[model samples]
Target: MSWAIIQQSLPMFGKGFELTLWLSFVGIIGSIVVGLICSLVQYFRVPVFRQIASVYVEISRNTPLLIQLFFLYYAFPVLGIKFGAQLCGIIGLIFLGGSYMAEGFTGGFNGVSKSQVESGKAIGLSRWQLARYVVFPQGFSLSVPAMAANVIFLIKETSIFTVIAIPELTNTALDLIGMYYRSNEYLFVLVIAYAIILVPLSIILTLLEKRVRYGTFGN
Candidate 1:
């Protein structure tokens, strides 16, 4: 591990880090939105949408993110649908992450007490009102730990974006190693770079989980 090589490579890694952060941020938000909608559809057992959401969750969760990215970046263009590398990476992350998030959220939604749901209905609360006043709050609280895990998972998944030519952390490290043949130095930095982003994120998520747990259960 040459310190000089590590130091020299910081600028390239910085750019890659920024791109990775951007991709992860966008992917996380998009996945959460998609997941919430799907979970709600499933939870409410919406006629056609419930089946669609179920099939979508199965397909997205079963498929690999790399394959998704390949289809978006390579195969789509053959049919006149075109997406840039970055866009493909973002879409791939959202496509993959959304399924997992949906499952997590569904589990949370299902954990809501049946009696409480009945009570809400007994009070003449409509489906939307029950969802807003009774279900979503408790469900979201129950799902926080799982959601945090998914966020970290999605962030780590950004490493594979390199295959789609996204200039993210892993790509920058690989490029430097190819040019300088300093695999140890570059790889060391790559690991550290990821740690820099994920470690604090994990800690923060842990704290958030504890807070939510305390707030929800009074424990």
Candidate 2:
């Protein structure tokens, strides 16, 4: 195996990695928000939103992330929709992550006690206060484990962005492979790159789960 040389095209890789991280961060945030909105709508049994959320969750969750990426990348153009590659990646990640996040939120919403919900109402909490102080806190806390898991899942899923040409971490590695003409070395770099990302993410989430497990959020 040829020895690995650090490609001086470092800025390119940096840009790609930054794009990956930013998109993942934005996607996670967006999906969580979408999930919260959907979960709340369904929890209240809102007539229209609930039906929409139900069908959306089922469809998005049922589809593979890669196929969804392709749908946005390839299929959307057939309908006269034009999205940038980055935008397509972001949207794909959002929908994919939203499905998992919504399921997590739904589980949390279901697990929350009705009495607690009523107790909030008994205190004369307004709709905003009820959701902000009462429902969201408990529901989110109860879902912390799920949230952590979702974070990890979505991070890994970001690799799919390469399929849509988002130039993420994997793309950088492939770039190095062709440029360096050292397949094994670049493969090692690929493993190292992902390992660097995955190890830290796992450790962080595990610690988060520990903190949440011992904390009193369930009432």
Candidate 3:
């Protein structure tokens, strides 16, 4: 392991880390929004949207994320759409992660007791009002820990963006390896950098998951 190579590559790794975090941030937010919309539409059986959401969830869940990224980055331009590599990566993460998140949310939404629905109905609450005031809160609490796990997976998956030449951590490490001809050291450092971000997140999410399960989340 070449400490000299690793030391020299630190700055590039720092920049790469920043970009990875940015993509993760955008991906997590987008996935949650998309997932919630998909889950809600499916849960409520909203007219046309329910069917569309079903198809989207099916395709996104079944497909490989790398293929999705390729389609977004490579195929879209052939059909007259264009986006930067980072944007393509972010879009892919949202599309793929959102499908899994939708499933998580669907499970959570379903976990809400039938009695809650009946109670809302007894109070003359409209469908939207019940969802907004009661169901969504409980569903969100149940789903967030699962969604946090998805966020971690999505962040790691962003390394695939290097294929499109997005300067994420893996790309940075690869570049350093190529420049210094020391793959082992660079790869080792790369793993450490990723762990730095993901480890704490995993611990926090574990705590939150326990809180949610024990009915002490908000307190």
Q: 101-180, model 3: which lDDT tens digit per residue?
A: 99989988887889988999899999999998888888888787778789888888888888888999999998877887
Query: What stretches of model 2 exceed 4 Å from their correct place?
Result: 1-4, 7-11, 114-134
Q: What is the lDDT of residue 197 in candidate 2?
A: 73
* Greater-lDDT candidate between 2 and 3: 3
Ranking by TM-score: 1, 3, 2
Clashing pairs in 3: none
Evaluate residue 95 in candidate 1 and report its C-alpha lDDT on the 0 to 100 scale: 93
lDDT per residue, candidate 2, 93-201, as tens digits? 8998887899998887667688888998999998778778877777777788898889878978888787777788877777777776766766675666667777998
Better candidate number, 2 or 3, judged by TM-score:
3
RMSD score of candidate 2 (Å)? 2.6
Q: What are the lDDT scores of the predictions, listed in order?
A: 0.93, 0.81, 0.89
RMSD per model, one decimal: 1.2, 2.6, 2.0
Sorted by lDDT, highest first, which candidate order results?
Answer: 1, 3, 2
**Model 2 TM-score?**
0.86
lDDT, candidate 1, at 27 = 99
Q: Model 3 misses residue 207 by how many Å?
A: 1.9
